[model samples]
Target: MDKTAGEYHFTRLETVVFGAGKVESLGRELSRRGSNRALIVTGKTLGRSKLLDKVKSAAGSALAGVFTGAEQHVPSHTVNELVAEARRVGADSMVSFGGGSPIDTVKNAAWQLMGGRAGSRTIDFSAGAAESGRGGDILHIAIPTTLSAGEFTPGGGVTNESTKVKGGVADPRLQAKVVILDPALTIETPAWLWASTGMRALDHAVEGSYSTRHQLVTDTLATKAIELLNAHLLPSLQMHGDDELEHRMRCQLAAWLSIFGMSNTRGGISHALGHQIGPMWNVPHGVTSCITLPHVMRFMAEVAADRFGPIAQGFDLRFDPRSPRSSAVECADRIAKFIGKFEVPTRLRDVGVPREEISRIAGTVLEEVKRANTVGVEVTLEQLVGILDAAY
Candidate 1:
């Protein structure tokens, strides 16, 4: 099918709630999704926080057990542990609490329960019709505290502890059945982390907008997502009072909308670079976007310049379709300036990737480009290194 003429399939995601204290309705929401027993999956810090208590209280009789073992990057071993725990507790559903890591950890667990294996490259995120029935009965609920919006997507990447390499699974049925976007829970997030993740969401909007598989449905959603994130992210970073809660809510909504197009689009240049460099260097996913997104935009502009019009327009910049390449570069500059205002690291070196390792990292990224159908760009090792060097 042509870009404008492609089909869109609704994911298995069924219910969502958004507000300050909407988490208090977790039990009711669980009922809405036809779930009763839930296993809470989260990291250590939040495992000890009052938010956990709040969620547990809200879960009440529905809570089966808690797994506080979620680590960054959804380590493969953790996925196993979570799987064993979910089975032991007889959990019919999983609740993901925290940012992308724990959310993805739960996704991996659901994937496993539904017969997916960690580190299995043979399993596509959109495993087609024959395998479509696998995860349909396995439910997951997400209560996100950061903007790394893994909860909304069916894909979840897991890293090998020994090799620091990443692999992932995606099946539409594995997407969270219910998502509760509680800005009240997000007030505890560290500012830099929140800001960096907002950039990650922005990356989603920008990437989806210019995707080669771009569709009218996704373009419209991506446009609104970009506009919402562009308007609210910076202000949401420094929450001061009740009014800021609404900004944070907008951010949460935008995060949900940003990756709405992923199912229909190929992974972009930014994602290919970020996917490798992130786990390889222990850089957080959000920080990877801060460093690589603008450079990837500029690099991809050669053939896809006109596709950037929505991105520039999202940033409230003037877009001249007559001068598409220049407009694309201008959009890149504006994105960089927006990222700079967050005071997060804007270079690979700043994020602790050694200067001497650029070539090695580039080789790894090229392999990722080959592995995923990313952006349709024939990226060479030299071009990859050039992008890294520029970011460095």
Candidate 2:
């Protein structure tokens, strides 16, 4: 019952409006933000959907143009192209629709439009500079279409095509100025992607809750996110078309809460490894998180057994507190089994990560020591290699 065992600061989106029919208010929100000329960003699939039509109709003349080239891993060239398009359209503000890729891209583009640089190379994590306003101003609004939960965070991930490394850009100014959470907008999301990303959100909550930097506030959000995701993700995936409203709303809420928790506490080994392997293998962020999460949990159990016990209980892993280590392993295994319910490939090789490349992947991940500052774990290179090997 010691709620304040950890102390930390919490931050979140400036304005969030969530509901079933909330997309109908898109134009009103844009106009209220003093954004008459808005650029809408989405993926190719979402661009061709009726949802895009809905957004266009809602925004009407306030919508300047649409950029549908958002891709997974957020390649640097894509960022530059989108930035050019945003400038070409003379957009005063941006609306990002779709998953983490589109959201992260627009967030970065907005930052660049506000004079931030598209990192010349892969992010140098050693340079932990605080982001300050550069005097250039362009507001950003996010309409997330999946539960990957990038919209609520102030960081964006972009891949350096030259090096084939994905890097993160952390800037408070990159946070969305307004977020409209319309579950209806998520109707177009494919089922596999939806469920896998929901598991990714659950990973965020789990990692954030037990993070060394976790605080009372973040713990509360993480707990709620866990409860919501456990209850809703499967149902959302199972009943996508039949029961759209409640299921999508729950997924949206879970995603938001996951990011809310993570924004404060940072994440753990799962994120650290996923951040490394995702871009290298062209894996989706959520899928990589799903594959690595349980293994990372098992690894973390040695140092964080006490924290794992409660999470085990929450997930209904029945075991005695005296045997916290066993219980923690059970918790990790149970999570892996739960993830299995979604039919996501649980092994790296299942997704085309060749066995021979394991060492190379591990080596690439070892280079991610820069993530240690934020990951809340002193993950050594040897330890990372072990994680990749175990996951393999």
Q: TM-scores of the models, in the given order? A: 0.95, 0.92
Tens-place lDDT digits, model 1, residues 117-193: 56753224555212446445677889999998888887788887777767687776778888999999988888888
* Model 2, global lDDT: 0.77
Worst 10 residues of 2 by lDDT: 120-129
What lDDT is reached at residue 44 by model 1? 96
Candidate 1 clashes between residue pairs 3 or more apart in a chain or in different chains: 125-170
Report lDDT (CA) for all predictions: 0.82, 0.77
TM-score of candidate 2 against the unseen true structure? 0.92
Q: Residues 170-282, candidate 2, lDDT per residue (tens digit)? A: 66667787888988888778888888898889888888766776666766777677778878788876774638678779878988887685655666768767876788888
State model 1's lDDT.
0.82
Residue pairs whose backbone atoms clash in candidate 2: none
List, in order, the clash count of every candidate structure. 1, 0
